[model samples]
Target: MKIKLYCRRALMTLLFICALYTTISSISNITLADMKVWAERVQQETNHPSENSLKKSNLEQKTMNEQTYRPKTLEEAIDFDQYETATVLATGYTAGIESTGKTSEHPQYGITFSGVKVKRDLYSTIAADPDIFPIGTILFIPNYGYGVVADIGSAIKGNSIDLYYDTVDDVYSQWGKQELDVYIVEYGDGTLTEEALKALNEAEALQVFRQQYIEQ
Candidate 1:
């Protein structure tokens, strides 16, 4: 009977050991699964780039572009869109604007209503021979600010250009076929500065003018 009791106790001890083993195995499995999930989360965080990081990268690229910005080249600017070869331009302006016929028709632009589709603004517009200064040509006059080759005239032939005036008296009083310095801003594959681009963009007419100039 003692021996039988001892065997029964041994069997009970074996069952308890098995139960302990099962509990330990379950705990080990749960811990391993948790470790796997944690490792995967870590990997994802390491591999994926954050939204802020991407934005920062883009900002850096933009900064680099700004730091390296440059205007247009004269070598490229001198080549006319239509002309096979670029011609040397005369340095001075020799012409005058008279409000006659279509010139006095209606103002194209500016505060005052002076007739022609082009304006009377100094930097905004100018009249030139289509043969010499084609429409949409950007010019830089020394005393004058910036002007475009917007209109053509019979009297505006050759290198002579007609500056716009409010009245015929203003035309004769201001400039009566006098010589003034004139410069072409750009021609052919010219580039505009950021400020210049902003200015051009603000004006719809200038944008169209630039497009026509570029396409040519």
Candidate 2:
């Protein structure tokens, strides 16, 4: 009887140990499976970004472009648009007899063909062909700044323009002559004053000028 009881106790202890081992193995397997699934999810996210991340990248690029862009030229900086362009042979002149053939003693010595006194300081006086750029037209030259078409010359025809200077020295030293591309910023009313008509009145030119410009 004593031997049977001792054998039964040993059998129960063995069964308990087996049950504990089986439970530990199942827990380890479940933990390993969960870890594998988590690692795969991390790798997928690294390979392919979400739509929200792509949108954020695009926004950053657009902002960078805006910050880098800048205005290049004077016209662009001032937001001024050119009405037309011309390639001109530019010449400099002064109010003296050497340039305008009119002495200071003359009645219309410093007066322009458009009947206004020359504004030599601003370089706002230019002689152009009335047929091309009429009186009051405004132009922008690269090296010489701004000039207004306020005069005409017998020699200034076609794409030739004459810029005004305060002195003959300025004419030679500042700007002798140049071939340049000029911007026409604004056009004139195409109307000439009575004094302008008188100044431009060469017999043949007057007849044509009257028919084309004055009559209309």
Question: Candidates' TM-scores?
Answer: 0.36, 0.53
Off by over 4 Å in 2: 1-76, 79-83, 121-123, 191-216
**Per-residue lDDT of model 1, residues 7-30, tens digit only:** 999999999998886798687765
C-alpha RMSD for every candidate: 14.2, 17.5
1-216 per-residue lDDT for model 2 (tens digits): 999999999999999987876787687765546768979877876798778878998999999998897544444444334357889999998889998888999999988888877754223668899888898777877756557788999999999999987788877887899998898887766554545433433345224223322221
> How many residue pairs clash in model 2?
0
Worst 10 residues of 1 by lDDT: 89-98
Q: For each candidate, what is the lDDT?
A: 0.51, 0.74
**Could you say which candidate leads in TM-score?**
2
Q: How many residue pairs clash in each candidate?
A: 4, 0
The C-alpha local distance difference test score for the whole of candidate 2 amounts to 0.74
